[model samples]
Target: MQDLLGHLRSGQVCYSTPQGAMISGDSLELLAQLPANSVDLFVTSPPFPLLRQKAYGNEDQQRYVAWLTEFAKLAKDALKPTGSLVIDIGGAYQRGLPVRSLHQYRALLAFVDDVGYRLAEEFYWYNPSKLPSPIEWVNKRKIRAKDAVNTVWWLSKTDDPKADVGKVRVPYSKSMERLLQDPQRYYTPKDRPSQHSIGEAFGRDNGGALPSNLLSIPNSQSNDAYLRACKALGLSGHPARFPIKLPSFFIEMCTDPGDLVVDFFGGSNTTGRAAEDLRRRWLSFELDRAYAAESVVRFIGDQAPAKVLKHIEQMTNGQVLAIDDSA
Candidate 1:
């Protein structure tokens, strides 16, 4: 366990790059070096135990929990009091049995509880193309109940967790007003006084509906992106990677600009890229040296072959940003 903050205080420095960098090492070991309550948010989808043929490496399911338990402890120390931890877990099946709905939810819930984290919310990300299960009824047997959903569990250290609802608002929808009349709706707001209208209040201006626990972000380009990286870098392995949008959304919802973010199991460094695009600092730790190198190239290459543009348009509106080329 490295005391990274101790070195920072002792004036023993290494890399000085302003942009976020990916470090090659085990996340558990690297997390020990980070300062207590230093990060604004922690987000990552650790490799689920015993999910065969997955991108993440395999480990004994029981031992995996122990490793994850330690990781959770280190992550707790890394988060600021106001910060949050959003974990995306892939469900697992019973060994050699076709137990379709056997998710690790209960075990995970218990693990987080033991680690002193409070369960805040559970999001169900419905992916229409969810992997099919063998033993249970065909997931696609129903029209609306297709094999399409993942879990995004939210956890916080304290009761008064800090979140920015305004930043996470989605585009407004006129149709949502219909729900306002429903008194039984869970999110019904008092302003419109109807369940149908409650969603309209939180919708964003981008024309998309307000974000919900069931995020519809497609797993696009990630597989191809990994294949491309493997080929271009001449590497033998292709790790399962996530898109930048997935973690970026949570970072914006949970943290402010210039805050620190950490991902111990950074497969493709999507978290780091999102932090940079959103103007936040980040530090990622990956065990695979090849993946780490590829991440650095992918992150830095975008800065090159790019032209610096400035906005000279004069508008009285509050949203127009004025850019001075010096920055």
Candidate 2:
């Protein structure tokens, strides 16, 4: 891991494990310094362009496309020929109006048409636990339904990126399981109204059903270890953190073990933790030193609150805390 990231000598290493490291610095500068074509997957949930500014900071709707495309241009050069870049961006409503902003779509086009990235695929993340937002539209006047879906753009440097749907398959539905049990008796192989022919291959159980583009993951994390550690140390956790499942899904599908994964906007370092668990080398960059230091809680297991606090202090004081996995 050190050999791969030794070039990043400028940024302060907040902490590190055998698999990856968390660095505190400007992501744009850090990203530029990375060796060209070294990263396998660059997945991140950048701060959304919302009507109200978030504590973590966000680009306004007007300049959001330009701001994000700058990063995309750099990431394109950093990615390997067969690498992938996955971005999870939430939709926003127009100021004082119920209409939705098209910034997300515009950014997508800029990444492909301008920055030379290919549109590998698009995904919609449905967060069932999301609360009804823009209360004036959804709760008070009831003009628009609750915005529960986020646009996840999967961009690639080349036409043929490294991905395997089999790696991230879901369990078969109940009806499908029944059909698989007795294909000849329960179902007939015939052409459907869609003009697609059903063959004997449908009966074969391929471990699990292929997952769809629409991912349903709940983001209701209240008592997780990261949060608990933050509470114990009297530090506020990063406000907007996507669930672990979101990054884990793409990590499993897009890259193999030992592949390099990077998240530029590493809020709470969720992507780093996910990659470490999967045995993939990762680097997470966050601008705020405090957040980067506090993120160490995600890696350390069941240490005393005082010990965790001590580690965080060391990181905040520009000391590198090498994590002992055996502990």
Candidate 3:
């Protein structure tokens, strides 16, 4: 169980705290520099393949699958045999058409069929609070409904990726709990309409209720430190920021304390923060220097007058905040 903190090398170091470091460079380059089989988990939200170009980095539909395929090889090379790669890719439209883009599906297939990674499991992140998008289609034309879900693909280098369901279990319903006390009285062990047998011990509490693959985690973070800092400093917010809970679920289930986690696409550095808060060693890479510099604010927990002021001081370092940031 050797720690890979010192082992990570590459890119311009924006800043480093005791928890982890964020590299200011291309993620693929950083992936190449890391030793083979060094990372325990690769959880990231890469630039989604959108129909329209986004201010934040994202690939166009025509070349998205091929584009993402290249990174799959690099990511596979860096992951340990027991490691998992959890990706959160958003849904996209077909520009003028009322159809949805299948790049997300195609990219998943490419990662598995081409890159030699196994499909660990598929999870969906349902953002209940998502605003309506694609004004022409969803809002104006009234053809499509609000796109609120993102596909979280869990791809593993090996068949047996390190995941414990017990760690990420949810609470059970009151009726379900009551039935566990006396199974025979409440329900009989018989076949149902769907021909699925209802076993007597079905209600057994294995810690808590198993979580569904359709995760209902709303992506709302108005009072969060990272967003707050970005706004006050006039640094444009990383538009596509996933909630902390999304990464938190996968990290706890797939990794242990001191396990090495990497976020190749460090936009808001949410994955790194989640890993650090959970005591997992992490490394992050972002091509944008400003975004990378702003990411440091998420790491600092020292006493400051205001959180925004703290972020500005940390970003500036009281000067131009210049360094040999090129890795």
Candidate 4:
């Protein structure tokens, strides 16, 4: 993994911890330099192709599928045979119309059919805190419901990619708990309309229940360390940042400790921080230098605010500082 870091130019690296490094550059260019078949998981939420443009950058909806497929081609070569490529892409409304764009679906097809990656599974991230969008249709007119779900496509190089649902299982629900307490008394094993026969093994305790494909996580980071540090430094954090739990969930399920995780569109470096906390080797690439430099705050644990600011200043000056994880 260190050799992967060596491939990056010193100027590209903003900072490094024992487990990961944050690089500032075009992800496509940086990704091309790394050794092929080296990444264990390439997970990220690239900028959405919306009707309007954002500060971070987004391809026009008309060209988004092709634009993203270019990256997918390179990413496929960089991923291990058993590795997964998970992308969280939000949907968009067509300009001046109530219709939704199909760019995300098109990208999925391109990644699988064109790029030769398999669709291991599809997941949807439901952000309960998301604001109602396309006010023309949803709010004033009251026609459409709030758009709160982002389609997450989990792709892999092979049919059997490395994954373990046990790693991300959720606690059993209230009804499930009652059934587990006294299975024979509270429930009966029988087949349902689905035609799958239920057996005594269904009453066995598996520690936790398997999670559904629909993930319900909120994106309400009003006062996290990353935002606080950015506030203190008078810097603007990445506008399109997803919740850390989003990437953390995938990292835990798809890769083990010491596995390599790379996030090419590393806005706010959420994936990098998640990988670091989970003890996986990581590298995040952000095109904007300021956003890359400010993301170091995510790794500055318990360090004095003054010293942390100094480190940010050094990164802004193009110096790569070694982070003290113990701090």
Residue-by-residue lDDT tens digits, candidate 3, 239-312: 77888888999999999998888998898889988998898888888887767777665655332437645454
TM-scores, in order shown? 0.72, 0.97, 0.87, 0.96
lDDT of 2 by residue, 42-67 (tens): 99999999999888998899999999
Give Cα-based local distance difference scores for all models: 0.61, 0.91, 0.80, 0.89
lDDT of 4 by residue, 246-279 (tens): 8999999999999999999987899999999999
| Alpha carbon lDDT at 123, candidate 3 | 97
Model 2 lDDT on a 0 to 1 scale: 0.91
Once fitted onto the true fold, the runs of candidate 1 whose alpha carbons sit more than 4 angstroms away are 1-17, 51-55, 100-103, 129-147, 174-209, 222-237, 301-327
Candidate 1 is scored at a TM of 0.72
Model 1, span 1-327: residue lDDT tens: 133434332122111135455565667767776778787788888876654655457565656666677888888887888888888876665566545433457546665768888777787765554455542445533322234566787888776667865677675455555443443463544555354444444532343455777777666444545445445544443356666667888888888888887777877677877887788777777776545544543433323222111111111111122122222
Which candidate wins on TM-score? 2
On TM-score, who's better, 1 or 2? 2
Using lDDT as the measure, the top candidate is 2
The weakest ten consecutive residues by lDDT in model 4 span: 221-230
User: Which residue pairs collide in model 2, if any?
Assistant: none
Ordered from best to worst TM-score, the candidate numbers read 2, 4, 3, 1
lDDT, candidate 4, at 288: 86
